[model samples]
Target chain A: MKPAIDVVRLARHPKRPTSRDFIEYLVRDFVELHGDRRFADDPAIIGGIGFFDSIPVTILGHQKGRNVKENIRRHFGMAHPEGYRKALRLMKQAERFGRPVITLIDTPGAYPGIGAEERGQAEAIATNLYEMSGLRVPIVALVTGEGGSGGALGIGVADRVYMLANAIYSVISPEGCASILWKDAGKAPAAAEALRLRAVDLKELGVIDGIVAEPGEGAHEHPGETMSHVRKAIAAALQELLVLDAETLVQRRYDKFRRLGAFTLDDGFSELI
Target chain B: MLTRLFVQCPQCQTTHFISFFKSADYVCSRCGHHSRLDPPRWIKQLCNRGTFRSLFANLKSLDPLGFPQYREKLDVAERTASGWEAVVTGTAEIGDMPVALAVMDPGFIMASMGSVVGEKIARLLEYAADRGLPVVMVICSGGARMQEGILSLMQMAKTAAAVRRLHGKRQPLITVLTDPTTGGVTASFAMLGDVSIAETGALIGFAGPRVIQQTIGQKLPPGFQTAEFLLEKGMLDIVVPRKNLRATLVTILKIHRTRPYPVRRRGDE
Candidate 1:
């Protein structure tokens, strides 16, 4: 029933565990922050100060609620511009206090509502990308669940990006892809297979740093074990990154991303020369 | 046999000659409906004669995800559009001031950014960094290509990182948003410009208006995601008519070339 062997089913479990599970099980004491300071607070993303193994860390991630009421409250984990702005503000705060920033990736995407756009959602995400790239602190991003597009990448670019074994990351969800390409949302199962959004595929393609293992059926069935695995993986990465100074850390991170996709030109096209 | 073909404008419902419509930059004479431009024609309109140097044209995409019919779609895209990816980036001169330019055309599979487009942008900006040239990117995209999956999504981060590196090096980035710049493209580098510009009637947003309407289950306001709407909302510096796009870039590049950007941060060296 758990479908652990089927990556799509494992990843797409409607009741798959959410980020609250991670913060609760992993962080010793977590205090959540609210608002982007410039706008109203967004419940879709949860951000604040937390201690990871006695080390102060800024924790941020998309928050999908457990029930229908919670989902409506959290906007089904679709972050708005304020959510990103809040995350950026927290990341900046973390930098000032020399705290490592931890982001848990899980979002279908940024909220696509009309108001979100008018309020500068693009500017917010772009600012995060520009600022986070140069932010002088250790940043770690883990794809704890559905890491979807710019909404996920809003906080996803980090010193290291990891994915839980059962997590899925994609530009567009299978349903959306199916609707757009084949004009049929019923073909989502086929679309999911074609997406190759499982952790294993992304890891092989050099899209993520590593894959954190899960204990049983996946995060939904074994949230505790999942949290522990993620905590250990993030701690190990932080230990490795904390050694270097700001300049070196930023440079190394940039270099790491810069080397992700390298395409070469074969000699056959030399006729133009 | 076929001497003439008339196409009706979607906005105005007016018929126009095919040759006349194309020569007019695909604009409707009656209603001023600005149609999308293809990449090669876009380059011709923006750059000096014989000055465009397309880099990384060989960085074509593969069917990494083994998505059904993706390879065949790529073949079709390559044949219909140019042999390049969604973005064509290179060093070119806007008049005398040499600028690094990236022009995305909706013709090339909706100018969607994938791994190749991302790599091209990152490398192009890096190239600009070495030369200390200004950047003006004409954006017309349907966002990230869904066929490439997460790899396409990663391009959002990768391209943003490139823009960051360019910014760290203190280069001027002027983003020109054209029709249909939405989704991942809008959420990343499309709005990161130091001075952002949108062409008149351009549709720019994180999501398509239809998607929003469906999500919220409501009727959208008229002219919701248009350039005029975005400008009123303070998202754009200004909206220029397509006719003035080249001149506007020239003016901006000239001023930037003359004055240069002041260093704004510590550790920028």
Candidate 2:
């Protein structure tokens, strides 16, 4: 029988692609960039220019450690404020170099430790948010695993956003939602359903652009299939987005984001936010 | 007998009937889960009668990304959740003081701050500051809008800059934290309010608790980042229940209504 497949296990324990794993899977030659320019380099978030399928693309993503010691070193894929700043730096670099930006979002979110905030965590994330919207590059973001929150959103803004079939994206986790709503986290399944967090659900809800097909069951089942699907989707999306001239691409990107989750009331009944 | 609104119990799968109006009066009975209420109902509950003028009332959403059938999906969500975008900005009178109010429309995408919502808020904050009005923002967000891409994150700086402007104008900016305030919105202006207040039992944090625990590979303490935790950590000044929010705002506003109003002069001057 196939191994017992828990989504969380797939998230935490799959013999999966590390951030560098994409270098081989997607990029041909990666020129690594380091540091926030204001401070020391953060190993947690690896970013730079790379050739994805020979298409010069800015490859940026979060790197988590495989073992306990590395996970600690990487902050368990939770980026510090500088990590985000580094991403912002690389994105701007891509803009300067006139390269299409492809960001792989794998972090749970930005680091929330006291040190991160003390060093302007909020400011870093805020600045990225500000600069990225106006950057002149075709951005295609993929949530390969856990797109937890702003940490994911840090590198997550793109002309086209895709999520792996088993990947989940939500403002918060279902367990957190359950604790908040039901006061009992055991009802996480209910919270998960209520959150509409699966790639399919998010795509259906118009929250995500598309869901890259995974291997049978989930991404963990067929790693090669998942990687191939991601590759194809990225190729197609980049081709589509790169067709537009810089101004049109940027404007379209801006407008595309300006409109999301809009609805009108039919009667006096309740509505979605 | 008042027909109870069919509230999906947060506990059991069964839907419990509660008086729509009265249950709207508070949280759910069976699970104590906060029932979703519209911005209008919320404003009515918190503001003086006939006192609100909504800003950006005509700011319709436009699809910039052209996600296929996005409009239809929006239609379904709007019908189901009953609000536009995820935030409603306006000027409202509370306890005879005109305050700029921005309430998260939780029914809409967990009150995610998309571009329109962020723009509306920034504009409202600017308007309030220009008018020298005190601002009261009730934040109940899941966070920045995923669909809006980088535009949603921009709201963080825009709103934060507006808040800083309000501070420069010497106007009070009160942020009321509500359930599920996480992600970009909380990491930005939501956490930057001058006098932060939270609803009882509200979840207030930058990232979700589960993500943190997962990242750290540890079990989180009970009530790790709730309103109580925030208050204890000095992130919040007060924690008020929904039932008491209006009176609390009135009391706080009355006590701090000096800067916005023209100073009274003595005859000696």
Candidate 3:
């Protein structure tokens, strides 16, 4: 076995692209929006109105840097409260204008600094969860990579949630999970198997709606081709969701989350075996 | 010739018989420390007599990862279990106001947030939102369950998402943080309440102080994560004594009932 692209291996894989890389691929002539208005602009999340095949859509996602300096600037794709606030502001704007929303998720999590907490990091994530559930617009979340914890979920609730073939989405990181469970971070690979965080596995668990195929090994190997695959998936999902009325869309979204996870825990667990 | 069982206060170096602590309702007699209360007794203490009706009692956790020691540990919890499976979710009356309540019990697996705990809390919140009832949650956790791996971790987001609906409606969500509220639970819904209440002497922070100390290699200041410090820094609204928690909750509920929606009672306003 070539050691399948589960979330754990995906975390270690050399070729995974960040959200910004994917945004460059998918968004065309995108006008960027900034600031939660109440707070200063956060660099970790990039949002604005963008055109996809002449169609206007509000595009938002976590952005990370390729180099050390950039990572420091981007916080390794982790968002602060302002980042979430900005996205919410834009999302509200999108709802008003009757535009579809396409959010790309790629973050280890929300920023956990003392300052971030003091400024209401958890509240921001919580607000998104509450507000996004009722947004009167079509929402499609694309987990490009590293769908970490509450940060990813900050922008993750949607009518349809899709994951890139190599992307992973879970409540916690594999390393964190490993350390807590095994008392050793070295057993992360083993923890990854237990997490069932890969797209296909999550799809089996019914956590994600579908998986967008990546090009050649993974998305980083062939970025352009990968974008094409993502572009097609987003187009199809949005087309379907856009037709539904606002009330129907919101109700469907709530019911979708409510029905998530197998009843009795074992029903969800039995699938893993 | 009576047999006496003594419990030691973890904070203070004082020891007392089980009866002494029980009569004191699990508070340390010497230092006024509130020992972690079990789920059933605490639930009874908070809710009106026979008014607490538990729901989602059948939802137990699954060992998805099949971690060697987890299932057996769960079985041990089950064998001597109270009415809840880590958390008690139900509708109860506090001072005669009907509210949907969920209390995390440290007695069961340290009141950890797992898939079931998250699900129960989320469902309860959504239920409260749908019915326009208030939500009262008592949070006491060691964070996420490690045995369930990522499934355990996802509870943070899942539960937070549920709390969002209630918060969005501006419904009263009274959260009482008991001893040692840390990790993902504290980082998510535990702190999202309209009024964040912490018991005195409770250790509340995102990361444990030891981790922070070791990571930064600094001798940290004392009382960094205690309720008094957090309250002084505006992280918590109130730090009520355990004896006053029930009365305080009742009064808060009364205020919630009488206050107008979208609470515009700022001093300047």
Q: After superposition, how far is residue B5 of candidate 2 from its true place, in Å?
A: 34
CA-lDDT, candidates in order: 0.83, 0.72, 0.79
iRMS per model in Å: 2.9, 7.2, 3.6
Ranking by DockQ: 1, 3, 2
For residue B174, model 1's alpha carbon misses the true position, in angstroms, by 1.2
Off by over 4 Å in 3: A1-15, A263-273, B1-4, B64-68, B126-132, B153-158, B164-171, B207-221, B258-269
- In the range B69-151, model 3's lDDT, one tens digit per residue, is 78897888877767367888999999899999998888777877777787899889988988888999888888777666556
Residue ranges of candidate 2 with Cα displaced over 4 Å: A1-8, A262-273, B1-52, B56-88, B91-183, B188-269
Clashes of each: 0, 14, 1
Candidates 2 and 3 compared: the better one by lDDT is: 3
A best-first ranking of the candidates according to their lDDT comes to 1, 3, 2
RMSD of candidates 1 onward, in order: 3.0, 10.5, 4.0
Per lDDT, the best of the predicted structures is 1
Q: After superposition, how far is residue B2 of candidate 2 from its true place, in Å?
A: 25
B39 Cα displacement, candidate 3 (Å): 1.4
TM-score of chain B of each: 0.93, 0.86, 0.91
Ten residues in a row with the worst lDDT in model 3 chain B?
B259-268
> Candidate 1: which docking quality band?
medium
User: Which stretches of model 1 miss by more than 4 angstroms?
Assistant: A1-16, A262-273, B1-10, B17-23, B260-265
Q: Which candidate do you rate higher for DockQ, 2 or 3?
A: 3
